[model samples]
Each structure stands twice: as structure tokens, then as C-alpha cells.
Target: MSSQPDLFDRSLLRSRRQRALKAAKPGADFLLKAVSADLEERLLLVNRSFGTAVDLGGHTGLVFKAIEKSGKAGQILRADLHIADPNQSPPDLVCDDALLPFGDQSVDLIVSALALQFVNDLPGTLIQIRRALAPDGLLMATLPGAGTLTELRDSLTRAELEIKGGAAARVLPFADTRDLGSLLQRAGFALPVTDLDTITVRYDNMFALLADLRAMGATSILHDRSRTPLSRQVLYRAAELYAENHADPDGRIRATFALVTLSGWAPHESQQKPLRPGSAKASLAEALGVRERKIRE
Candidate 1:
């Protein structure tokens, strides 16, 4: 099989993440912490416990801390592309987004938050993750969906096209809900489920939104991103368009973040499987108390 296309620059991604937490302190990673907390809360609703867990691409250990608090795993290991502060707890493994340093069928659970969207080879990463899981092992992760930053993406494209007579990629691509499910199945995971939640945040202006993205280490890092700096004229026009199109009643602009949550399990004989066709004992018409008409062969 052919290899997956390289989409992101790993070194640049690591630098941005390091810079984002350079002024690190309590609550510095506010947005990441919020999403990690939400993901952990939802994971707990599944009511499953694991003996060993790994938090892949866990920036600043926020998601790992959440996993620790749930008491769902006996031993929790942290992995990421960057090494965290020495004063803080160090990670168990430091590696690239698409690499996994674990034995096959060893981990009982794996959790990632706001990280997989940057992976250059998501299908390969998912396959590695599935291979690392023990039988019936669970994987729970959340990443920004396709609808994230729609307003900004639209505004930027229009402004750049109008000012420069062309446009370069400013926003990175996101995974669609169907694509996530297909990847899980392709990776040989069982009982996969994927869903999305929309979170709308209001910013005073487009600059504020951009700054927040920068602080969160979420700015564009696509491999094909434009090297030249954006012109001030384009930036100003983009801001004006954003405010005009997505402004709230209070004059603040609305930014939409669609978070996609995915859950899947390592294949196991005990897990539920779909029955074969023509095996059902009851008919839909009978169940609904309606007449059933058969077409002549």
C-alpha cells in the first residue's frame, strides 16, 4: 500500500506547543484543560475501568491528570511530542504524534485530547493505537471537527483572495464524523462510535480569536502553508468581514468549535457483533401491526 501524505510539520508543531506552555503555570492551558475535563467526564459515563492506560499527545498532562482522577486505570503513562517542565511531572514517553512506544496488546486504555487533528498519518496512528490495546481495550479521544473556525476560515479566504488575487492555506483540514468512523473500522477496532458537539465562543474581535488560537498552539501548521507574512490590509479586511458576518448582538464575533468525540474498542470475542442478514425472527411490519406486501419474484 502507498504511504499517507505528509500534512503537518512535526518540528514546527513541537515548537509551537513548547512556546504555548513556556509561560507555564497553573491554569495556563485553560482551553485544553476545559476540553480534557469534559472528555474525562464523558468517558466515565461508559463505566469501564482499565488496569493500564496511556495518554497519547497529552500536552502539559492535563488529560493525564483527568484520567488519574477518574481512578479508571491502575497505571497511567503520559506521552507527547515535547518534554514538559522538569519542575512538573515528566512524561513517560516523548515522541512524534504518529509514533507509539508500546508493546502490542499491552495497554488497557488510551486517551487523547485535542491532539490527533495535527497527526500527519492519522490512520497509521490509529492502527498503532489499536495494536497497543489489549483485547476489549478502550480508546477515547476528542479533536476539533470539520466545522471548527468556519467564520475565520471563510473571512480569511475572501480577504486574501480580494487583496492578493490568490489565497494560500490558512486553516488546516479537520476530520469529518464519517471519516473518523471509517478510520476506526479500517484500523480493526470494534464497536466504534463517533459524535460531535458544537461550542460557540464570543470574542471581542477577530484579532482576539486569532490570539487565543496562537496561545492554544492551534495556529496553522500545514506543510503547504504560505511562507510570506499576511498583509495588514488583508488582516484588517478579514477582521471587518468576520465582525460583519458573525457578530453577536453585543458586537462580539462568534467563533464556532466543533469538538468530535470518538470511542472504540480493540477486537475481542466477548464484544457484541452484528448478526448476519436473514437471521431476524421478527419483521418490521409485524412489529408495527401493519400489513406486509411481498413482491412476486
Candidate 2:
């Protein structure tokens, strides 16, 4: 398939996120609070094993709940596209630019949470992540993958097509497990590991789930949003359609989150490299009687 314009673009998605935050403020907060434990576990693991770490796309420090509490790190750098203040500063904060402003391989570990999906130049970003890491440094991050919001998105699209005559843009674009694995390989990481976790939460209604997205500061941020105020007509229509078509039998809505976690090591020169084409003593076909037959067949 052809690559998408902002499919993995972070800046574009980051710009679109504020709207979602505004719309689902309460929900995003609740959702992040809910996932705080899991995120902390991921963070703690990063810290205990690797003393000095850098948090990329480290929005508001939601993921690293225990950073300040621990006396472990010599320093932990918290980086983001935009940060209000360093808060405490030693594990310094820097707003993002086109590239990471750090010396090569200076970081011991890299941690990012729910941030990879927004990157447009994903491979390049991974390469940069690699470059930022010291030899044997670890990179751990999370992103949304397939099966996220399946019910809501599918119902909304169906409802719009049936009544509104056209469908709205996608709520989010997510890669599947296989796609993520391939991306890890392409990024030149050693022993890349990718896995998915399915989290299902029940909501009083559709609005509740939307709220979660807001508090998490993870809402859709398309470059284009019709360029004008969203007409109440569209808004109301969207809500009505969502409720009518997606409501559960118990009157509760279900929101599903598929999170992909990736772990990788920067490539080391000591690792084995594939041999040159003619470096082998003899080709297998030459030793076997089927040599000519293998070539012809």
C-alpha cells in the first residue's frame, strides 16, 4: 500500500490533539489515571535497568509517575514537543524541534508513551532514537494499533453513510502487529520486540469514552477539520448517529484500546553480519546432484 501523508506524522497529529483534549477533557484524564499503573510499570522497568533515561514525547509526565520519587537516576531527561515548565529541571525538559537536540548516543534509555503513532517520519524518528542511545541502550515505547475503537468507528462510519450521505475522516489511523514488526526491523534496531495489549472499558454512554481520550491528551488532530466552526448540526447528528447505531444492549458503550509496545536495542557492530554472495566455500546447489535441474527449474 502507498504511504499516507500524515499516517505516522507526529507534528501533524500533535497539532490536532488539542481539539480532542478540549472536547474530551474529563475522559482523557480518567483514562490516563486508569492506565497510570501500567504506564508506571513500563517506566520503572526502563529506569531500574538503565539508570539514565530520556523520555521522548513525554507529555506532562503522565507515563513516568515515579520519576521524581525515585533517587535512582543520575538524571532522567523529560522531552516533549511542548512542555509548560521543567517543573524540577535536572532531568531537563526541551520542547521538540525537527530533531532531538542531544549528542550522539548520550542517553542510556528512551521512553515514550502513546506517542509513536503521531510520528509522520517514523523510520527516521527510530533512527534518531537509535542515534540518541548509547551502545546497548534500550528504546521502549507504546502506540495504538489495529482494533482500537473498532465498534465506535465502524458504527459512526456506517451511520454517516446511511443518513448523512458521506463519511467523516477516520478517528485515528493505526498500524497492525505485523506492520509494526516490519517497521521495527526497518529501523535497524537489534532484537526488536513488538506486542499488543487489548484493554476494554465500559462507559455509561459514548460520551464517556470520548472523555477518556481528552484527558489523555490523545484525540484526533487532523490537519484539516473543515476550516470553520463545527456546525452544531454536524455535532448533534454525529452524537445521535453514534448512539443510535452503537449503543450496547446494557445501555453502556464499550471502548477498546489496542496498544502496541515496542522494545529494541541500537545495532552493535559486534553482531553477526550476513556474508557476501561469493564468500561461501560452495553453493548448496553445486554439492547436490540437482544442480543443473535446480538452476533450470
Candidate 3:
């Protein structure tokens, strides 16, 4: 087990997710809908079908629905901290994202959408996922990347500094795309790939954006978050700052959501491997049709 302290309040996050599900309104899951479509598109590109697929931390089964619609996998299972609706088809596995329960080489595919970002120990979780996958099994997931919510982060920081004389951690820290790619390699995944897609949403004001975040259960649950509620003055000032800095000509403020997609396969002997350093058949100079200039030691 890692000795490092938890970055997010997982208990709080679970409760917040439950609350959000109870109060969810139409259009509250717009981000999930967009991510689900992207996941389906990516899955469609893969030619082969999977025997058993697990939806890891899939909120409200959007990713599961996507996978089912694609007809790419058989025996789909949903796993989450809690079932969003007991009346509906309950999740097959109710478990935390950080601690997966599966035998070695058990699952053929795992898909997660906008869920792994809140995990306290993402690297460990990735390792566990890799261990749970069959040889050549695939993992595809999407989460908010480093550039997400920059406007709101800046506005909140400035506002808090001006009003409270200091700023606290108001936004959750997101993983960088390169860092996530490196993690896939570290977790022993083969043919790892990471890509970014920026989604910009325009809101009438910062408050509207905040409301949407709350509805999505995406509000900050950082373990070190300030206990005191944000003052109305600070909130209004942040809104004003957001408009001044990130608003469009039409007076609508823009919010950025940087989605980072990750894909990798559990290592297998049949997968492609890189050639040895000196195994190239043709020299670089020959390939480029240029005279090689050696660097002086």
C-alpha cells in the first residue's frame, strides 16, 4: 500500500455522487453523454470483439450503454461505488475505483468514462486493472486533463485571494496527458496511447457553470479543501472576474473541459514489439537521402 496521504475525500465524493443522482435533472449528464459517444466511436474502430467487458466506475451506465450499442463486447458488467438507481438495473459490482476485485487475467476489456480522475492512487489502480485483464485485453478510459476548468480555477483563486487574503484548493488537480501515458507504460500496458480533446462550454455566468458542476457531482472534494463556505462577496467577485477574463463578445463565459483519452492493452507475446537499438536495416542518412553529420564528442 502507498504511504502517501489521500488527495481526495473519497467518502465525500461517494456521498456527493449519490446526492447528485437523486437530484439529477435533464441535461445534467451532458458531459457523460459526449464522452459516451466518443468511447463508442473508439470502440467501433477496433475490429475484434471482446468476450467479457467491465465498466469501471461508470456513472449511470452511460459507457455500458455505449459498449452495448457498439456490439463490440459480450457479458458487460458495470462497477461503481454505488448503484445510481436501485429501481433500475443495478450495477453488477459495487466497488471503489481504487481497489478493484478481480482475478488475474479475468476480464477481456475495461472502459471507464470521467470517473478515474477522482481516484486517490491512480497509478496503483492502473496496475490493478492491468493485473485483472487477460493477455491482450484492452483498457479505454477518458478523464478531465490538466487544462480543464482553468477559467474557473483562476477566477476562484483571484477572488479568494482578494477577499480571504489567501487562496485554498478549490479545484481538483488533473493528470497531464504525458504523465498518464507514462503511467500506462509503468503499469505494464502495451501499445499505450493518450490523446486530448478540448470541449468548451459557454455559460451565462460563473454561477451557472458552478451549478452544472455540482449537478454532475464534480465539485471539489479535495481532502485539504477549506471547511468554511465561500462568502457571497467572493463568489460574486469570482463571477465578475470570470466574465472579464474568459467571456465571449456575447457576454457568455467559457468553461474548458480537456478530455484526455487513454488506451492500452495488457501485454501479450503476440503484440508488436519495438526493434532492438542496432537492428535497423537502413541507416538514417539513407532513409532521409542526406549526408549524416556526426556530433563531436
Candidate 4:
């Protein structure tokens, strides 16, 4: 068995997602829609078409729809924890993000948007995804990066410290872009790349931001989160702090969402490989027209 400590409450996350599904409205999934469009744009840059594609953790079918619209895959399947009604649009499979059902080298492409951040064992999940892809197949995913929800975290921490003399974790910790890139390399993906996109959203007040978070099912699900409900006093104080610290001149507060996109391909002999050390014929000193210095023994 793996010895990694569990950082997220998976059960609570599932419950929250299910609740979001029931309460979802037209614009509640704005983030997902944006990410899906970005994924499609990236796929358009590739010239080849895929035989089969899997939309892993494609909540509400937005990513699946984006993949379908891209016309880059012959067959597309959607997988998620919750399945829609049989009469309505339903996922091809219902499964957890940590456990994928595809066979080895079976899928030509896999896309996941805004779903990998909640995974407790992200490295293992990436390894599974790499194994599931066919040779030279591609994986593209988006995850919330370290800069997301910074203003809210600071406001909540300060308010709780001032009112209750202590603070509990109110937000989920996100992975760093560099760390995620390294994880992709460790998972046996070739030509791994990670890039960040920061989107600043303006809200009238802290309450508005909190409502959006709740509607997105993005409230805290940390395993170490405090069980006691936040008192109204603390909530009001948090709002006050948020307004005092993060508000703009027009009386609007700003929230940051850092989306990190990761892309890599399953290893194949045809892919480009880095040159071996000491294989270059020309020396750096000669190339730069400078004398090389040697350290004294």
C-alpha cells in the first residue's frame, strides 16, 4: 500500500460536487467553459487526429462538448464521478479520478479540466493516465495553481485570528507550476510543459465571491478543516477585512484564479530526444569567442 498522507476529504468533495450539480445554473460553470475553450485551442495546433479520446473528470459535460466541437477525435468518451440522468446527457463511465478504467495503451488522447487539483494522489493519477495512453498519445489538463484564492485566504486568516484567536484552513492548497511539470516528467511523459494563466475577477464584496465559490462547489474540503461552523461574527469580520485590504477605488474586490495548463505525450521512438551530455563537437568557450578558465587544483 502507498504511504502518502491523505490531504483532501474525497467523500466531502463528492458530496459538494453532487450538490453543485443539483443547484447549477447557466453561468455557474464559467471557469469550466473557459478552460474547455483553451483546451480546444491547444488541440487545434496539433495537426494529427486521434482515434479515441477520453474526457477524464469532465464535470457537467462542458469539456466533452468542447472536445466534440474541436473535431480532433473520432470517438470521445466522458468520465466523471456523477452520471447525468439517462434521459438527459449522460457520461460514458462513472469513476473516481484516482482510478481510471481504460486499458494500457488504449486511448489516443485524454483531457481533464479543473478536476486534478482535488486528487490526493496526483502523481499516481498522472502515471495511470500515461499508462492508459497509446504510444505517442497526448494528455492535456488544467489545474488550479498556487496563486488561486490568495486574497480570500489572507482575509479569512486575518479575520479568524482577530476574532477567534486562531484560524482554520479555509481553502485548498494548490500545486506549484514547476512542481507539476516535474511530476509530469516523473510520470514518464515526454516533452512535458506547464504554463500559467492568471484571471482576475472583480466582485462587489466578499460575500459575492463566497457565493460564487459555493455555487462552484469549491468550498474547503481539506481533511484538517475545522468541523465547527464559522460564526456569523467571524464571517462579517472576514468580509470587512476583505473589503479593507483587497477592495479597489470603485468599491469592488478582486479575486485571482491561476489556471495552470499541463501538456505532454506518451513516449515513442519517433519523438525528439535531448542530446546527450558531452556530445557537442563545439566547445562553449569557442562558440562564445571567450577563453575558458580552469579551477586551481
Candidate 1, residues 1-297, lDDT tens digits: the string is 996668998778878887777755454466677788987797678777899988888877788889988888899988876556444577888877687888899999999999899988888899999999999999999999899999999999999999989999899889899999999999999999999888898889999888888877789999888999898999999999999999998899999989898899999999889999999999999999998888862
- In TM-score terms, candidate 2 sits at 0.74
Better of 2 and 4 by lDDT: 4
Single out the weakest 10-residue window by summed lDDT for candidate 1. 80-89
Give the alpha-carbon lDDT of every model: 0.87, 0.66, 0.92, 0.90
> lDDT tens digits, residues 175-281, model 3?
99999999999999999999999999999999999999998989999999999999999999999999999999999999999999999999999999999999999
Which regions of candidate 3 deviate over 4 angstroms? 292-297
The model with the greatest TM-score is 3
> lDDT score, residue 16, model 3?
86
Alpha-carbon TM-score of each model against the true structure: 0.95, 0.74, 0.97, 0.95
TM-score ranking, best first: 3, 4, 1, 2
Q: Which of the numbered candidates is closest to the native, going by highest lDDT?
A: 3
Model 1 CA deviation exceeding 4 Å by range: 1-4, 25-28, 85-87
Report the lDDT tens digits of candidate 4 across residue range 151-230. Answer: 99999999999999999999899999999999999999999999999988999999888888887888999998999988
Cα lDDT of model 2 by residue, 1-297, tens digit: 976565434564555554443354433444444444555566565534565777676554665544444433567777765443233333366555336786788887777777677666777888888888888777877778999888777765665666668776547778898888888789778878888888887877666666666556666665543344434565556567666666689777677889888888877786556788889997776788454554456
